[model samples]
Target: MRDRHLYLLLLPGLLLILLFRYAPMYGIVIAFQEYNIFKGIMGSEWVGFAQFARLFRSPDFYEIMRNTVLISLYKLAASFSLPIILSLLLNELKHLVFKRVTQSVIYLPHFVSWVIFSGILISFLNPIDGLFNAILANFGSTPIDFLGSSAYFRSILVISDIYKEVGWGTIIYLAAIAGVNADLYEAARIDGANKGRQMWHVTLPAIRPVIIILVILSLANILEAGFQQVFLLYSPLVYDVGDIIDTYVYRVGIQEANYSYATAAGLFKSVVAMTLIITVNKLVKMSGQDGLW
Candidate 1:
C-alpha cells in the first residue's frame, strides 16, 4: 500500500508503451498474409512461409543485408569508442564552466531532427554550390558530389552520426564515471599513477558495466542503420552503399505497397535482432557481467 504512489508514477510510461509499442505488434500477422487493404487481418488469405521464401529469393536481399551490417558496424565501432575517450577527457577538465560549455556545444546536435539536419548536410555537400565545393574551388579542384558518391556516402554517414550522438553517449558515460568512488582515484594516485593511468585503471574499470550494457544493446540493434537520416541524405547513386533494411522496408512496403513482402523483410530483421540480443546477453552473463535482464 505504501508503494502505491511509486506504482502510479510508472503508470503513464507503461500505458504509453502498451499503446504505441505493443499495440502495433498485431500487424506482424501481415508477414504471413496477402494483406489486402479492404480485407482485414481475419479476411486476408494466409500463405505460410511464402513471403519469407520470396524475400530470401530476391537478389537484392543479400546486398541489402550486407550493406545494413557494414554500415551498422561502422557506426557502432566509432560511436562506442569515441564516447569513452571523450568522457575521460571531459572528466579531466577541472574548469567547471568550460566543461559545461563544451558539453552543451556537442550535445546541441542531438536535439536537431534528422530532417533538418540532413537538409543542412545536403546543402553543405551540394556538388555545384555547396560549402565544401566552394572550399575545393578555392584550391582549384573540381566539385565532388559527396552524398551521391558511393565512395564517400558511407564515410559521411559515419562521420555525421558521430557528430550528432557521440556527445549524448559521452554524457551517459560521464554520469557513470561520476559515481566512481573518489577514494579509488586517491588510491591510484598514491600508487604513483599519473592522471592518464588513473583514468585507465580507476575510471574505465568503474564504468565497465555501463560500457558492457551499451555494447550489448548496440550489437542487438546492429541491423537498424539510421532510417530517417539515410532516407533524407541518401540518393539513388549512393543507394548501393547506403540502403539499409529500414529504408528498404519504407520503399517496398510504404511506397510500392508490397505490404506482405515488406512485412516479411521487417520480420526477418526483427527475428535476427532478437536473436542477437539474446545471444549477446547470454555471452555477457557468461563473462560474468550483468546482462539487460
Candidate 2:
C-alpha cells in the first residue's frame, strides 16, 4: 500500500523521536526525587511533591512567576501582531527587489547571537555618549541608562525580541498571502474596494487560519521569555523585572547545584505550558478551525 512506503519514509524520524525525545522524559523523575550528585538519579531518595512545596514557599517564586508571565505577555502582544503588520506592509510593496532587500536586512538580526545583540543594545542605550542618550542630550534632556533601569529593561527585552524575530515570522504569513487567489483582489477592486478594504475583506480572511494557529502556538509559549536574551542582558539591579523562570532555574540548578529544586521549578513550568497549549488548542477548534491536534 502507498501508506506502507510513507511509514517507511517516516521510520528514521520516528526512531529519532523515541531515542532523543521520549528517552529523556525518564529524567523527569528527578522532579520528585531528592536529587544528589553522589546518590545519582536512580539512587536518590523519593520525596514526592516535597520539592514543589519548597519551590512554592520560596520568597522569589512569586516575583519570578510574575516576571515570566508579564514579559511573555508583552512579547505575545508585540510578537503576535508585528508579523501580520509586516506581512501586510510587505504585500503592499510592488517592487520585488526592494521588498527582498528589506526582508533580508530585517531577518539578518535573527541569526545574530543574543550575546552579541545584547552588547549592541547596551552600547546604543548607554547613559553617556550612547546614540539614544546623545539624541536626548541634543534636545536638552539628561542621559538615562536604559539597560540599568528596571522600568525600561522589560521594554528593551520586548522591543529587541520583536526586532529580531518579526521579519522571520513574516515569511510564513507572506507564503500564506501568496496562496490567496489574485482574482479575489481584482474582483474587490472592480467592486470599488480600495487596497485597505481589499486586504480587510479578502487577504486577511484567506490567511485567518494561519494567524489563528500561530497565535495558539504563541500562547502555549506564554512562559518562555527568551532565556539567552535575559541571561545576557540582565544585571542584579534589574533582576526584579528581568528574571524569568528559565534564568532562575539555570542559576539555582546549574550554577548553585540545587538540582532537585530546579527540577521542580522546571516541571512546574512544563506542566503550565502543556496546560496552556491544550486549552488554547481546544478554544481554536471550538472557534471552528484546524488546531495543533
Candidate 3:
C-alpha cells in the first residue's frame, strides 16, 4: 500500500514520456519515404535510403558537418571546465552575502529567453552606436561589425553561449562539492595541504564521478550546437562559418519544404548522437565510473 502511492506519482511522468517522446519516434519512417502531405504517412511512397544518399551526395553536406562538429567541439573545450572551476572558487568564498549575490547575478542569464537575449546581444554588439563600438571609439579604434563578420561570428556564439550557460552548469558541481565529506578536508589540512592541495586531492576527486557522468551525457549532444541560439544569431553573411546541422535542416525542411531530405539529416544526427552516448557510456563504465545505463 505504501508503494502504491509512489507508483501513482510515477504514472504521469511515464505516460508523458510514452505519449510525447516514444510515440513520436514512429515518424522516423518518413526519412525513408518520399513523404507527401496529401498522401500522409501510410500512403507515402517508400524510397528506401534514397534520401540519405542524396543528403550524403549534396555539396553542402561536408561544410555543414564540419561547421557543426567544429562549433560543438569549440564550445565543449571552452565551456566544459568553467563550471567546475567556478564551483571550486565559489566554494572557497568565506562571505555568505558576497557568494549569494555573485551566484544570483551569474545565474540570472540562464532564465532569460534566447529570443530576448539575442535582441540584447544585437543591440550591444551593434557597430555604429552600440555599447562595444562606443567603448572602441573612446580608444580611437575603428568600429567592427561583429555579427556580420564570419571571422567574429563563431567567437560571439561561443562566448555568448558560455556567458548564458556557465552559471547554471555550476549548480550541479556545487551540489556535488557540497556532498563531499567534511572529514576529508580536515584530513587534508592535517597532512599540511593548502587550499589548492585540498581542492585537488579531496574536492575534485570526490566530484569526479559527477564530472564523468556529465561529460558522458554531453557527448551525446556533440552534434547539437544550440539550434535556438544559432538560428537567432546567424545571418547569410556568416552562414559558411555559423551554419550547423540543425539550422541546415531548418532551412532545407521548413523553409524549402524538403521534408524527407531534412528528416534524413535529422535522423542522421539522432543516430550519431545515440551511438555516441552508448559508446561513451560503455567507455565510462569500463573505467569503473557510473554510466547512464
Best by lDDT: 3
Q: How well is each residue in 67-113 modelled by candidate 1, as lDDT tens digits?
A: 99999999999989999999999999999999999999999999999
TM-score of 3: 0.98
Candidate 3 global lDDT: 0.93
* Native-to-model Cα distance after best TM-score fit, residue 265 in candidate 3, in Å: 1.0
In terms of lDDT, the poorest run of 10 residues in model 3 is: 73-82
* Rank ordering of all candidates by lDDT, starting from the highest: 3, 1, 2
Please list the C-alpha lDDT of all candidates, in the order they appear: 0.93, 0.91, 0.93
- Model 2 earns a TM-score of 0.95
Candidate 1: deviation at residue 34, Å? Answer: 0.5
| lDDT winner, 1 or 2 | 1
Q: Can you give the TM-score per candidate against the true fold?
A: 0.98, 0.95, 0.98
Which stretches of model 3 miss by more than 4 angstroms? Answer: none
Candidate 2: regions farther than 4 A off: 1-9
